[model samples]
Target chain A: MVMIPPYVPEAFLTMYLPAIYAGLIVGFIGTMAIAMKREEIHILILTDLVGLAMIFIVSAVGTDLAEALILPGLVVELAETLAISEILITREMRKIEQDPRRNLSKSSSLFPQPFSLDMEIMTTAPNFIALVLIGYGIFLTGFTGGAVAGGGIVLYALSKKARGLPVLILDGIAGVSGIAWCLWIIGFLLFFVAPQYWLLSLFLAACGLLLKVASKVGLIGLLMREDIDKE
Target chain B: MEIILIIAIALMVIGAFGIIFLKKPLDKVIMFSILDAGFVLVVVAFKYLDVAMFAALVDPLSTLVFILAIVKINEIRKNKVSGELND
Candidate 1:
């Protein structure tokens, strides 16, 4: 068996690493300085800039391992943004004596007028585009696949909302996604305890992960529909 | 260094500055998208196609989240101001 050559991490670090670092420094300082003078909302937005800088620095390593490292970073950044945004909204709602949950459940049209869903392409396109995305996501399998698949579902759901579609089966979709999550965990456990069952583990992990991601993302679409629904 | 890499770096730096200096939430989000595009291109330049694909797909969702947050915040501010005026 031919041995795969080990990747030298230093190879890329020596060339143009300084440029990447400069970007990172600028990002960090810029956000910090601006954040000092801004409100919570602006500061929250600025944090995302810091994340971009971190990505630039991390990707400068230019190796497979480094590439893999970037996934966790991205996930953490996304989670941070989501959690912070939720907290900001909830706190603000409560400050005004509004029942946050009630507001979320009842509000329609997050923006002003002309935000209407009357586009001609909304009727013609999203289906094909979402289909292609979901197909590509399946082909990519793993975390990247999940992102692509989730994106497709989100797009499809948004378009459905634009067309005035009702979201009826959200709980069912969430339940199935939970089951897929369990399967994914079992698949990982199997990899460690039953190495001989590699094929079974691989199948479970890949399929379960893909399904879990797609359905969870689809739920985002449904939830957005619920939020934006006027009825 | 390749011309593409240079351009990508420039884009990111410009975006970073724009986000910091631009006071409006909408403008910041727009600049953030520019920064995201540059980051994705840099990943592509480094030949990590998988990571780049993931970045491209997820960036929009993050931007959407930001926009939603900004809108909600603005709405809350409006309600507070109007309520104060009514009182």
Candidate 2:
């Protein structure tokens, strides 16, 4: 009779232990801040910070798994950030509607002044940098690089002024791709339950990656459309 | 490396406190950015250069989104005020 010892994930856990601890501490602090401060923007930032910490903790696996994990974590954070921002904006809009005296501008200096060339240049620079990032990411590690680059493009589009059909289209594409990325993570988790689920997980991951690419391309299409419309 | 991680963690903790205690939204945003930089440093210390790069890329985007949202909200408020005054 041959005896085989049960495999333990101890080594994996140990490697990620510090990250996990940091994530937990940050997450706790974020929650506490939200509870104590009751500020939506602070909550959003803190929660996203926690999410970023979680990415580091989760990606402490093998190099390949780490790469696979990064995108899903990022997509989750991005989606939440967008959703919360929308909610905060809507809430502020409602507040202004109810009370005209509410001085939003006086309250926050973070808001950019109306459509200055410097502001436009600042916003547009990220898109070009995203392209460069995509190029370098591809040079470094093929698909993972592509994923990060695609995310950068999405960020670029999000940072730009949201206007017209083009912005709407990009938002829709980003929302779908973000959901697909989350689904990919779910599928990846399911793969650990049974070896047979590997193919299904791979399919989900591929779809997620394709959707991300589609979203990035959608941003480009939006840009071209804007140019033509301006002409 | 461990020392670097400790420093990063300490920075994050301080940022967290700042976020909770800061009076203004803009101040909180700045604190959040600092916390983000700390997270990136920790990832770099962990030798996950790719993840670190991704963090660096994403951080500015998140900040920009927040700023845009704030700007949009302010625009809506100003427009509404002007509309009311005209009425």
Candidate 3:
């Protein structure tokens, strides 16, 4: 397997890996930090192991870690895990244990957005025929719709989070994606969408964990501050 | 071939829909973990061990993060709720 493709986007590694590493570190620190620390520690250790394995996986493959022929299963599994945990946490919080009932049953009334279907169909288009054409086009004369889409997604995310520090970070990501693609737009380029799924995915997860840490560090204060400074 | 794929597809669909319908972010995260498990299971059955392993491990870890995130976000919301109440 070709390990490192030439011209790996700077931002691809920069924005992504750091975030993942952060998550691992957080898991370690978290495992140590708990009072009910015995049983919970194993889960954190599992998280750390999984994070490390991901790093190895990314180094092995140079293509879509999220959607490689080998990737979707991981994505779906990850999604499901999140679902189950989400429920457990919801119940553990000891508030409203059940989901709120909605009077209307159809997808239409629930979402209330008139155009979600349209948006879903449109988003899938990139994964459709255009993807094949674009991939071939990039292969033939070095035209990259993938990079464009990647950058576009980042930009779209920035717009979606227009008013926060996350927006700044998102914009930074989009900017990097743009710079990464600049060559693909003009000349032959090598992309390192790594194969070490465990490694990179773990890294991303780890880094994102800082957001959790920051939240925790200030949590008590935030609670107190909320009451005192209620505006 | 068809039967297995169908099962995987069904899990993915149901899990996907279930997660979205959840009001609590934490619940959403849990449903997503289930979805991830079902998908990973399918991948293994299809003989994609490497992918399945990654799914098996990483998916649940991701859930941990999501749970943490939702907890944090919920904290923020509750803080805000209390603030609103105090006001």
Candidate 4:
């Protein structure tokens, strides 16, 4: 009936969904921090583009369909990334306005604006190394990224209505997948069948919470303001 | 019957708490990374080596990009400093 995991075992993305999710969260948080904090969004943007490039290359390079869909996602991403950047900038501006020490040059704060490469290397490099993989480079690999492939311009567009909602949604989708996958593996370590559906639900829950945060943060309002400010 | 499973599961639970309750930004990053690693450890443990490896690689990439972004935003923030701050 439900066709739950252990009942069927290995339900498509359930296996690698976790990696997709982990990458998405990293990409989402990474980009959001850069967009709002950095003066020059291009540098980190390019680095992320490079990261996406790797995803694109790995997913689409030899596969014809992947190549076909490449431009679609990238084109949408260009506009979407910029839109998200603008919203982030606006929110940062709003936060800055609130600070009583607005005049104090509070250069360093939690996750200070403009990302930290030095710390990234010490802290995040190992995580990124994990993203480069493609499931034994054989059986598990697919034609497109899980998040990207989940839907297309249509779903992305639907999520866009959330106003900065799409990116958050996409990131959640990917991050949760990573978590579920980790659980699946642990299940294996204990000699058990993966609870594929349960894992999916966990990822979906995280995505839902993150979207709620974005909405509450006034991120969408920031987007609206940017569109009207026309500065 | 097993300790490894307990440790792995516990890490995930704790990582979740850290991300939610932590106030410090650096701590948030640390917690997030741990959450990420814990996630990877889980996937790989289940013989989902493919998923595990990718999970391991992505969190860092995400972290690197994140740090770079924060730095860039700070630089821009500094540039935008108003006259009042300068005085």
Candidate 5:
């Protein structure tokens, strides 16, 4: 026979959880109230706050596993925002009767110059920053590593374009990317088919992921540059 | 509450209010980044370094997308309004 306590708090309950909950409530209510009166563009910005609220809720769980879960949710949030933004732009472009070229020329200076830096610093900063990020990313490995490395590559690509430097595309980059995909797949298969070779599989998967992610992100950067050049 | 937690909460609350109430879209974007920065701080407070790393790397890309959308929309609106005036 066991004597049960009259009241027992939940294991996961914490003081901070309440604060997070309050924040989420505030975020949601604020977004809803303001979104009702705003245009589509304004509403789109509000949606990101909703995503942040979701992150707060998830992180309130306060566990290593729960924290890991936030990464995927963040990625999904980014992807959704991107797709919606693109769709909105396309719809507006089709609905409006205007010459896009003229507008593009007028708005080419999308980012304002906030500084009067020398050209020497501008040319070297991107390279240094990208190298540091990529190196740190490689050391980290896994999803975080991929993200860091991908960001570095994107910055590098964009900086190249900003300086009017030609971004060289290697002929075999695509082929290497394809092969890396196979490596990742094979590594996954081995995890299930041959659990004993876990170490080997892990190495193969990490290497493949690094190369695959870098190549794909690099290609995206290149596409963005081309689009900007077209404009 | 811990100092870090207090700072995080402050950043987030202020950011939320600013994003909702700010008159300019650029200000809203700026507040969004501030909110994101607070979220990263929370992650750091929780000792989830890996998650924090990913979030820090990703936040700017999302902001860039927002900026791009804002710029494009504004340009489109300007052209449409001017065309209407001409007509």
Candidate 6:
């Protein structure tokens, strides 16, 4: 008699089989939607949803690196969504502007509705929450948290009133942080050459991650400022 | 738990189709939001509570970003039309 050991326990498979099948079905449908849709926005949305479903399926399967990937995966997904949305919005707007009948009022456009009073109030609320996050991050993670919280504050402020010397200061901070991130990456790579530098490399890597986060948040701030100016 | 996961996945698939098929941008955005909810459900089912919380926090920010982009594009289009009229 020959015996084969199951890598995944039969009990485990039984427990999660339905979820696995469901994820597969959902992913397939999303891909099909993308193949069928001609609209840029529609394709973007379907692709994003499909990507999200794939992540869920991967996580459910208990891949060794799945837990570590969840946060970064969500962040990348949002970044991609932002990029696609920006492209689609720009293209649609250009098309509208070029049209002779683009009567601003009657044009059937995908432009977002104007913000309501409630939304304005909600936008401001992020500032305070970000302040708390900064305090907590700094308390927990030191300089790294400081960078994140600082960047977040700048982002919130810029979104609200992107102008003057403050905006210039934010830009300067972003540039500095970007440089710091690059240096840290170099330090991380050199850690293999000198084992003694491992601790320093790790610290710098954390700094680099935080700086990268700050720079991205600051970019969003600048974008918001530009968006407000366009309005 | 498995049943909940299945339901969430089904909702997500339906939402995805709705987003692709819906003609109105507002309706598509609404469907996107529903898909986001389905994502949260899936995360929760996988017992990644922390991830679910983070998704709850970040998903709305992405939606806000999209909305802002849409508003900005509209403003730019309006400005271009006005500029052409003046010219």
Task: Sort all candidates by DockQ, best to worst.
Answer: 1, 5, 2, 4, 6, 3
lDDT on C-alpha atoms for all candidate structures: 0.74, 0.66, 0.45, 0.49, 0.73, 0.67
Please write out the lDDT profile of model 5 over residues A1-231, one tens digit for every residue: 533343433564554558587767968785776658657778777777877778777766655766788988887886788788889977766644365655544423333322221234326666776787788878876666777787788767754644443334455777888898899999999999999999999988988888877776776776565554233
Higher-DockQ candidate of 1 and 4: 1
Best first by lDDT, ranked: 1, 5, 6, 2, 4, 3
On a 0 to 100 scale, what is the lDDT of residue B63 in model 2?
A: 76
**Per-residue accuracy of model 2 over B41-78 as CA lDDT, tens digit each:** 88898799977877887787667656655555656578
**How accurate locally is residue A141 in candidate 6, as Cα lDDT from 0 to 100?**
40
Q: What TM value does the first chain of each candidate achieve? A: 0.79, 0.52, 0.23, 0.25, 0.70, 0.68
Error of 2 at A198 (Å): 11
- Taking the candidates one at a time, how many backbone clashes does each contain? 0, 0, 53, 41, 0, 0
Q: In model 6, which regions exceed 4 Å deviation?
A: A1-16, A93-127, A137-155, A162-167, A228-231, B1-87
Give one digit per residue, the lDDT tens place, for model 4 in A62-100: 345555666466656655666768687777777867874
lDDT of 1 by residue, B1-87 (tens): 599999999999999999999999999999999999999999999899977876776676567556655775676577667766776
**Ten residues in a row with the worst lDDT in model 5 chain A?**
A113-122
Q: List the residue pairs that clash in candidate 5.
A: none
Instruction: Report the C-alpha lDDT of model 6 over A1-231, residue by residue, as the tens digit.
Output: 524245644565554657677778889999889899898878887887787777767776554566556657766776799888888877778777887375444433445434322256346667765665555544434244544554555446545643454667767876887787786768778788887878888777766666666656656666555545433
TM-score of predicted model 4? 0.36
Q: Candidate 4's error at A117, in angstroms?
A: 5.5
When 2 and 4 are scored with TM-score, the better candidate is: 2
| Deviation in Å, model 2, residue A12 alpha carbon | 6.0
lDDT for B54 in candidate 1 is 67
Docking class of 6: incorrect
Q: What share of the true interface contacts does each candidate keep?
A: 0.06, 0.12, 0.00, 0.29, 0.06, 0.06
